[model samples]
Target: ERPNNSRFSSCSVGNISAVLDAVRDGRKRDCLKEDAGAFCGNKIVEVGEECDCG
Candidate 1:
C-alpha cells in the first residue's frame, strides 16, 4: 500500500485485471491495458491509499 501520501500516492499493479473491472463497473471512463496505472494520476490503481482516511 502507498500509505496515503498528500502528493498523490499510487497502487501500481502489474496485472490489468483491476483496470478491466474498473472499466466494466463504470468506475473508470477509459484506458489502455498496456499503460497499466499510467492512465490517470488520480486513479486508485496508482494511489493505493489515496490519502488514507486514517
Candidate 2:
C-alpha cells in the first residue's frame, strides 16, 4: 500500500519501450535528471551511447 504522502508505480515494459522509441524519434516529452548517471550506468552503456532526459 502507498503511504499517504508518497506514491509508487509498477513496471510496465510496454510503456517504457514506447517512451524510449518516442525519444529516439524526438516525439516524447521528457524530464531532466538532477544527477548524472550512476557509476555503473556507463559500464552498461552501449558502444554508442545516447542521451537520457530522465
TM-score against truth, every candidate: 0.31, 0.35
**lDDT digits (tens) for residues 1-54 of candidate 1:** 575554432454434667878888988874754544433445445444545233
Give per-residue CA lDDT, model 2, range 1-54, as digits (tens).
337435324456677777788888889665434765444444455445564223
Flag regions of model 2 displaced more than 4 Å: 1-11, 32-54
- Model 1 residue 51 CA deviation (Å) reads 41
Error of 1 at 11 (Å): 12
What overall lDDT, based on C-alpha atoms, would model 2 receive against the true structure? 0.57
Each model's Cα RMSD: 12.2, 12.1
